[model samples]
Target: MTTFTALTTLDGKAPAEALGAAMEGLDPAPTGVGVFEMEDGSGLWEVGGYFDAAPDEVALALLAAAHGARPFAVSQLPEVDWVAHVKRELAPVEAGRFFVHGSHDADKLPEGRVGLLIEAAMAFGTGHHGTTLGCLRAFDRLLGAGIAPRNVADIGCGTAVLAMAAARCLPDAQIIASDIDPVAIEVAEANLAANAMAGAVTCVTAAGFEADPLARRAPFDLVFANILKGPLIDLAPAVADHTAPGGHVILSGLLTHQAEEVGAAYARCGFNPVASDEIVDWTTLVLTKSG
Candidate 1:
């Protein structure tokens, strides 16, 4: 069966959330609703709803008007087996000694290399993205340089691929994977279990390094943050606070042009850039904290 989506944008988080909440009460209520702040540096928040059936345009218009949002744009979406498509489309991604693959490509996992089983159902960090790949390669390079970190943290770890890599290579190290979205944490746990590394990496639902699980494990020797440019800049100070002197941070999810700014932010927090690699439009940076 086909589905329909209604989307609108409004200023302010409150109005967008209120509009999303209002959408839930409509007749033929939405199967899912999302209210997100657009990351384009545009001050707009997008409110969207998915319905199994066509939504009432009048109702949507009224809701938008009441919320001071633009008129809802509704569209029909074709029903497709997204999981199957992803499995077929995403082959194995190799970054140095790490291989990220779905179960469909399990046989392609090479010998003597660490294999991370990320299923197609998991929507984030399949390692196909340049940012994720860059982070993995950066870590691999560090390992080659004989940088062995005993305490590590993976902030905004969507699928926990980076954390898992650290866990596999540094079996004796303590690794924690964290994400603000609880759903991503669930995905991380699933991925960990799939890799038979369930207990190797602790999974937490927290923003940046705020929660007790992360705070108690402070002064990390290494940290991985594959999040967007804005959050990476905002997180520079907190990352510096939790990192030990001479600790390393592998940061990605930045456009090539944004890397310099992020590097400058970290520099102000006593971090010196060690390496900056650009893969496609994304840039991954490796920086070490100065004593």
Candidate 2:
């Protein structure tokens, strides 16, 4: 069946989310809705909805006007096997000791390197993105320096690839992966199973460190957060609180220019910058909490 989509862009997150929420009440209500900040540094948030059938153009127009968003662009998408398409286009990505690949490339797992199976699905962090790549490399560097964290948390984990990497390297470490989106948590669980690392890492749905599971496991020795700049900045204090003194945090999902500000935010929360790796337009930061 063909899918219909309506998309619009607005200036801020609140308005964009408001618009997405309104879309759910439409006459031909959307099956799903999404509100995401445009990654092009335009400061614009894109609100989109997917419908099994065509949505009411009039309702969409009114909602867009009400939310001060651009006029909704409605279109019908042809049915396609997105997973197969993605697998064909996405080659295995190698970052330091980690090799991220889809199931189709299972035979290509390199010799002696850690392999993480992450199929392209409704989540993020395939290691193809610069942010994910940089984070993996940063973590590898920490390992090279004799860092053996006994407790690890991956905040906003999309597919739990980072957490899985930790699990592969630190077999005895206690690891938990959390994301605000339930769908991402589901994907993370699936990926964990695909890697045959099921039950090796706990998965939870929570925003940042707000989940009880995370709070209960506090004072983590290492944390991985590859989220956007806004959320990353807001999470600094919470991350610092959950991390033990002298603990390490690997952060990414930042444009190169935004790295300085994000680093400064963590620094104010008692974190000292240890390393920064820039790849293309993205940068990954590694910081140590002050003892």
Candidate 3:
């Protein structure tokens, strides 16, 4: 196991930053990867993993592809096995009736309780982040209120956490989960299988609701979009198009400051905001389409 640190110029940081953000929700995690915005307005990324050969070789390859930098300063951390450390840090959390773990723990779903093991690899929605957790809580509330969606679509379904939760909650419901990234689709499929839900959830690689076939199959009874603000705004109409009359939508992954803009986007799509929940800097909005 080895850890490598690489620095990037201001211009070189953008690609890696995007990749890091895309991967923040992966399960089993992704090589303990992270990008830090430096105080000097530059960027640095740290990656650690197990390697049978020279660690720098792999590190250089990743940096070259992500940051487009060659010979980017590589420093090794002595006496620290970062791969093991990260796996330990990402160990599963069992709280109350929910057992949350990385993809590796997928087979270890708790007995008699609904299991949601996500393998985020390099996407978001592993339930560790506050936004994901908030969405999960919101889903729980919806279920508690006896809101069982007959058709559900998890837009931007990074790792498919929400889709799986919905499937478990509504055993007879149809689920469609999609992500723009191919890697996320793979992870989501693995997660659905790990939760013994392969038969119930459909996973695909799609950028937005308009690009997904399931969205065209039937109007969704509920839709979950946990994407960034920009895409969320742009996809609002498509979301409305896929949602049935009087159907529900769960929107998250925005700062409180951005809620108004997001809400306005949905409102324009004929979704009336029913509730908004805030936790820390993140906000989750529940909206329903007007008949």
Instruction: Tell me each candidate's TM-score.
Output: 0.93, 0.96, 0.71
lDDT (Cα, tens digit) per residue for candidate 3, span 204-288: 7878865647756669989899977777888887888788999999998878888998999889889998888897878889999
Q: Give the Å shift of residue 270 in candidate 2.
A: 1.2
Better of 2 and 3 by TM-score: 2
Which whole-number lDDT from 0 to 100 does residue 38 have in model 1?
71
Candidate 2, residues 53-135, lDDT tens digits: the string is 88999989888898899999999998898887898889999998899988888899989999999876632689989999999
Instruction: Report the lDDT tens digits of candidate 1 across residue range 145-226.
Output: 9999999999999999999999999989999999999999999999999999889999999999989989999999999999
Go through the candidates in order and give each one's C-alpha lDDT.
0.94, 0.93, 0.71
User: Where does model 1 exceed 4 Å of error?
Assistant: 11-15, 39-44
Candidate 2 clashing pairs, residues 3+ apart or interchain: none
RMSD per candidate (Å) reads 1.8, 1.4, 7.1
Q: Please report the candidate that would top lDDT against the real structure.
A: 1
Query: Candidates 1 and 3: which is better by lDDT?
Result: 1
Q: Is candidate 1 or candidate 2 better by lDDT?
A: 1
